[model samples]
Target: MRVVFLGLAVPNMNEYHNMFTELVVEFRNNGHDIMVVAPTYDEKVFGMQVEDGIPTLRVPTLELFGVGKIQKGLATLLLPYQYKRALKKSKIDLNFDLVMMPTPPITLVNVASWLKRKYGSKMYLILRDIFPQNALDLGMMNPKGLAYTYFRKKEKEMYFASDYIGCMSPGNIDYVIRHNPEQNANKLHLLPNWAWLQPNLGQQEIIKIKDQYGLLDKFIVVFGGNIGKPQKMENIVALAKSCTTNKDIFFLIIGGGNEKEYLDRMILREDLSNVRVKDFLSREEFFKVLQIADVGLISLSENFTIPNIPSKSLVYFNARVPILASVDLNTDFGTHLEAIGAGLWAEAGKTKKLKEKLMYLYNNPEKRKKMGENGYQYFKNNLLASMAYENIISRVTNT
Candidate 1:
């Protein structure tokens, strides 16, 4: 089968940890041809850097992030069609069997519809984050009369265009169903997260990374991902300040974000040594450093109602490091933690709760280890890439 993975992220700084890569690899290994068309600016490649070893296309895009709201919105409109044309031109010998897609930009829906009309192609919507609604919840979208109606219509058009839709968790499915009750259930399948096998170097990798980061002797809790508004770093910063008395515990945050410069400024203004912030580390360094982390932080802003089941939590779990979340326990994430016994959760914006949870995890190595092991088990049984691929294969083959 031939496939085109439609993405609205850059080639790098895509925090899904080569999520599309892993799926493409599986399909390729199984004698399928796969291609990816994504929005990536050469200057702003975060984790979604242009990866090698795959048939890929980089469509010039109107960049998102930072203070440029107008340009970003304009870019989202053109991105979908730009991606489709790029693929159509490049893979002249091949046409996509399925266009697997996700978005902050809903243009792909129209692109898929174009493909369907032009070549009878089917679209698989990987609803990673529900736009407009998620954006509305995040206070990004202006939910006023005209703008609301226009964007809402676009959202439905995108959904209606998709032949099959996939969501990361049941909560996400529920949210979608809540919005579009008439949509077919069989079309809205659960798209699980995935895990990668870690290279086993025991404590030596940790010791080495610690030494390199000048954190060898410190109890470091790593929040290694984008430091965007979504992460709500203010809460974590408060937690770092609270831990100043602990002396041995340090908050190590490593990743790039539109908010990276702001975080840098915050660190300086607060005069914090307990919180060591690093820009996006290289992929090789990122993986190696994670192996040494004592704990990983999974966060989403509180008051965020757009259903989010973070994929990074499973990555931390697969690395055998427990997760420390700053998200509301009322969500599916907290339920997942309790269900798998993977880690602890705190209210999204509560600095006191974050501090308390971090301290407790630091003191309980046995529990942390147990949670890590449990997370790995859960990843194997549930979130591995193979599971999602199986679902894709079943649908693609109609078997």
Candidate 2:
């Protein structure tokens, strides 16, 4: 099948391991032609190139991220127009069987609709980030305001344009259905976040990473990825603060975002000796460090009405690391983890409960190892790239 994948992220397979690259590679291996129509802000003109044997069309637009909120909003609002104009100028082949896109801006309905019209393609929506509502839940946007109304309309348009909507979790599917009663109920399906599993690190390499980071004898609890508002970093701060009494337990935070400075200040002001903060690591180094991690961490704000299953969890699962999740009650993330026997969880604001869970892990290595193995097996059976590819292809092709 000829497919066009659309999103804000442009995956360079050599630089990092991402789900999109895994899906693209698998599709190509199965004899499918794929074109990645991704946004690029570095160039002023639309350009085309072949990367890793797949055609990538880079469309120039007001850059997303690394900008203020207002500018970011403007860029997101203009993405569809920029992408459409760029694609038209390319004069490339438009015969596509399926067109897949993810939600962030929720402003790509125009481009996806155009592709569907032009090629009679089946448009698939990977509902990774539900918009306007997420903003509303975070109090980032007023639901009754004009901006929210406008984006809500666009969100509906995207939903209507999609033939199939693959939600990140069952909770996500429920949220969409409850809020958007007009949407086709049959279209939504549970599609968990996935990662391409890499080979396990050697014991020597793992030891080297542990030693280099001075974590050789510490029980490492890692919080890795974007330190943004939705993460409700206060919970992480509280967790870190509570662990100060236990010198054997360490909080290793690796990631940068709007909230990094806040975390930095807190760590410094409190003289957090048990915690360490570092900028984002290279993909190779990040994976190596994952080997020494005793537990992987995921955080979500209590304010979020939407159940967000962070894609970061998939990385931990790929590395066979058990999760320590602090998410809202509405989210099924904790429930899923418990069901899989892969991890423990506590509510976002329940620092006491989190401390108890942490102590449990500290007191029990057998439990930790068993949970990590269960997580790895669960990842292989449920969240593998092959599973996602087959599910998507089967649905779209009725195969």
When summed lDDT is taken over every stretch of 10 residues in candidate 1, the lowest stretch is 43-52
**How many clashes show up per model?**
11, 0
The number of the candidate with the highest lDDT is: 2
Q: Which stretches of candidate 2 lie over 4 Å from their true place?
A: 44-46
Which residue pairs clash in candidate 2?
none
Q: Score residue 397 of candidate 1 by CA lDDT.
A: 76
lDDT of 2 at 254: 90
Query: After TM-score superposition, what is the CA distance of residue 214 in candidate 2 from its true location, in Å?
Result: 1.2
Cα lDDT tens digits, model 2, 55-113, are: 88888788687677788999988888988887888898888888888877688888899
Put down candidate 1 lDDT per residue, 18-40, tens digits, no spaces.
Answer: 77677766776678777666766
The C-alpha local distance difference test score for the whole of candidate 2 amounts to 0.86
Model 1: number of clashes? 11
Least lDDT summed over 10 consecutive residues: which range in candidate 2? 9-18
Q: Per-prediction TM-score, please?
A: 0.90, 0.97
